[model samples]
Target: MPRNRPLAAVLTTVVLATLTAAVTTAVTTAPVAAGTAGPKTVIANLFEWNWPSVGAECGASLGPRGYGYVQVSPPQEHVRGQEWWVAYQPVSYRIESRKGTRAQFQSMVIACHAAGVKVIVDAVVNHMANTDKSGPGWAGSAWTHYDYPGTYQVQDFHHCGRNGNDDIVNYNDRYEVQNCELANLADLDTGAAYVRDRLAGYLNDLLSLGVDGFRMDASKHMPAADIAALRSRLSRPVYIVQEVIYGAGEPIGPLEYTGNGDVHEFRYGKDLARVFRDERLAYLNNFGEGWGYIPSNVANVFVDNHDTQRDVPGTLTYRDNGIYALANAFMLAWPYGSPTVMSSYEFTDRNQGPPSDSAGRTNNSTCYSGGWRCEHRWPVIANMVGFRNAVAGTGVVNWYDNGWQHIAFGRGSAGYISINDEDFAVTGRSYRTNMPAGRYCDVIHGEKSGSGCTGPVVTVDSGGWFRADIAAHDAVAIHAGARIS
Candidate 1:
């Protein structure tokens, strides 16, 4: 298990003061490229967002909400198309795509860094574009099927063919899964030194532009050795969480790539979704390893990703506003793996792009307008970000549940939360907390302004308890950071 790192300047609280004096210092602010993550650290995946809009969001919301990093869409040149999948296909390593130009990409990095937020780009090194798609791509770079000008040649890609069309049809075979074409997209032969060098150069260029890490696309298709080789060439290890979706019976597993970095845990989302939607609140008392998931430090957990929201059945999404917010609140409040909040725009079709102007350029997102759901901006979810940060490094404490509808817990003395998931409401229920006697703002209901709370206030007595009556499908959350007096 990875130990939680202490913050540089700890929050000036009685508990934090003692934690600070533990004396053995740890990692912070040096880019979360690779290591066991701290509890306070959370990254938000801003899928399909362009540069200017992302920069604005970094300044307006992300940094203030305590997000340590933002994983953006692939910024390299890709097929000049509107569909979201176009980003996963590459035309060249040139930092030019629908998101923005190289200059705009650099500017966005600078802007995010100014707000103390790091940028982790979605690095699609697994494949080039399909042969059917001829490319004078988004940045006007002309290319043929296997020839990327000034970089990869036809020899750089694998020609493995088990199926007649060279597509990967056998998931059970390791060789076929790694070397064959995925969805008929051109697969790169990542093992060759020439191929490794070109891939490393592309990532190193991003590093020069102040990128902190990468979300390795199709990492399951590439050997762990190939990724480790690519990382060895870099000056230092950067955060690299691979997209390797493996369950109980998969041939290849996430352990294969842990040497390189972390993997975005798909199982974590599926497990939580089942209990929350079914209103099985009792099973959650033992929510972490008992439910079968990766450990807290190594796993990058989320409630839903861009793909799962559209394709995966029974997964909670922004459409399920009441239920989805409830799940997100649970994910944040629980001391599980390092969490990633999904901040995405709304889409009816699976292939729809962001809201665009007449010229097909992505319009600046107004979030609530322009089809952007912007769940990160929701008051309940936004305030929970601070709640999670304040309670960093603390274990779950004072766990209380009514065996069905209501469940309440504390994070040492830093925070406390009670969730009511049943159809009926509960009134004036006394709940135990670990916090000292004081009135705290329930951040999920509203924010604490100046000396007043915009939400309901909970006053914990000298004995560390409070009485709160929450409605069905509602939650109550309070932390020491928001204590008004």
Candidate 2:
């Protein structure tokens, strides 16, 4: 059900005429370090990527580009199928699936750690596969609806009698939402001690394999207290980000899960898309909590994750083209929650799986070909990872906007970026910052080459100002880490 849940929150678009206005604000906090020795929270979600491909990416692109963590899809054995949703249908806790075998999974983790990147596995512990029929799992484990051999049986599941079936219908009912089956899948009785121990045993098995964290799949169906209880059973303290999607008036909201760990701020992406599509860019000045989101510190934000890209309309995805890159740029440059850059495969069919062989083993992604659209490797998005790390703890300063589709801001003296979404090109503009006078490579369009830049190089004078022209729906970013010596 993780792949099929519907969004309960309704986002409204506000249209208004462009206005002219200027705003400035300055805030400072203790600097946080990123890179090898410090905390690097930026995540690259390589959805549906096979183990080998994920490991290769860590060495070739993710590590060198400064991405600290790579969030991979679930690794457990799942129901035999080619659809991506099949990955969410847990047949067993064994680390075997279309992705790879247990040994391959361990090797991938080792490779990632070697490249200074941690691995975060997607954990689907809410329920098992839909029990419409009985079948053999990908790893040859036989399962039928609510039963799996050597695993849980009928007594371990919740059989809430409702809607002529156990399927969840009324989301407003807390008991039904938590206890009833979702999408005909067998729901686990998480509150039961035996079931909790079984789930924790599965997670501890993963911890033994060197996983750094987990993205708890379908956390909404499992109560926040249940998840906290599950965490207490972990072998060691690992980073946990729960997928408690926010619904407008739902009794079970994201705030209830903060004590557990970081919760996905579903509002950030939907509201961001609304502003970019129908509203003005100036509205982003007071983004984050000011816009009614969770506390920034524990808020995990993304433009469009795997679920949102397909299910939640209006949220920016890889399909938005240049606008998508600009949105990612804005997300990385601005001081907000820890952001995740989505890497997706091109698909016309929503349920279609990634490129795979006849036996359903995922093929290696060549990027920009063979149906793999590696957005994480795009020049603008990849280089911006470095920008985010460089400006980690700085606060927004010298904020400037044209009150419509143009805006610029500085991350203290660490970095600065100007984005223009207007139809016409914005030219002959000088942006002032507190960064020391130096030559910096516009990371959005180029890279640092030797003592110079491979593309446009902007020079800041003694006054900490640089003049540049930005094309429609484009961005220019410069940071201290990419300064040309």
Candidate 3:
């Protein structure tokens, strides 16, 4: 069903020489930042994999790929059900849940750490367990409406009702948001002394197990003051990323959490997806600013996340877009935000459990197997992982675009990339690629062969400019240090 196009004739040797010369001149003369660390790109959206499955799948696959970190599923105790939402219901601070036992979770943390991949746990501390009439949770912990046995009780929650619903409805009212139930899930009072200590203890426990940071869910529902206080008590330097989904005009936004850690750049993902998939090429040149973007360094960008993929109406479907693969390639190639790539299993319904058998047991399905769809392993997507690591910390320079179909750019002379999304061939293009004189690999199309690239070797001459022709619906990336000039 998928067809690969041939290299365009316009990408001739003569044009490449000219572009390479221009690129070199620009880079060599530009002023450099003192001791500036190059881009550190991290690609992870560790989907619905429970703890054991994460260890089994991510530990071995992501580490050697040079990923800076892996975003894991929530490790707290959750409700017991055949549906996926059960995990969103937090009953206790125990590491034990349906994903795996405590030992399996710890093993995954250790394994990922050993492989050079930092682990960021999804923390649902904004609330306690849901008040469902169901008995106990997956961890066998008894739970009441706002009471968590042996952990916390309803007295720890703020007693407030809005329109006959006990849940907090006032977003403008910060107090209610932090103390009210989210989707009927029991809300915890982070300001409470005992609650703060218990949460800190839970976080400290995760830190002891080698967790690098956290993804705070339902963060918009928590008060900024309380969150900062809690963050102060936790292990310093934790990679804290808060989920404050602010789109268009929702009032509450990500700005409140910037002091705590990096906030999810939800708007960036939507804008980029639109420009890359539906809009014209002219819109992409100002990619960040064109959409009222955030500072690239702090934004956590992704094409489509678990929640949006499932709930957003009329949005781009992941299955329809071979575009997802292309989007990820562009994200990795571009030095924009701290990128996160989603790794998900196939499901018929939005609420269906992950790759599980009839008994509701999570199973490790192999590639081409019926249940799991490991998009991360796709050749195009997997290869970009290496590309991101190779050019980490480099700023975008020598940017070029051909109409709305093709885009080419370089990252601090460390790497250069070209992408073509049109159906027709592109020709006569020379752009500056500030890398030194050397032969480099086009990673998108070629695998690393020995010390140099085996196919599509981009040679930067004594000058900086080079001619580049990209086939329709194709992408090519050239990185430094891979070949001899």
Best by TM-score: 2
What digit string (tens of lDDT, one per residue) describes model 1 on residues 232-271? Answer: 9886678888888875676888877887888877887887
| lDDT per residue as tens, model 2, 293-335 | 9899899999999888885457888766666777888999888
Q: What is the C-alpha lDDT of each candidate?
A: 0.79, 0.83, 0.69
* Candidate 2 pairs with clashing backbones: none
When 1 and 3 are scored with TM-score, the better candidate is 1
Backbone clashes counted, model 2: 0
- Candidate 1 vs 3: which has more lDDT: 1
RMSD of 1: 9.6
In the range 146-233, model 3's lDDT, one tens digit per residue, is: 7778888878876667647777676666656666677777778887889888888888899988888988888888777777877878
Question: Poorest 10 consecutive residues of model 1 by lDDT?
Answer: 27-36
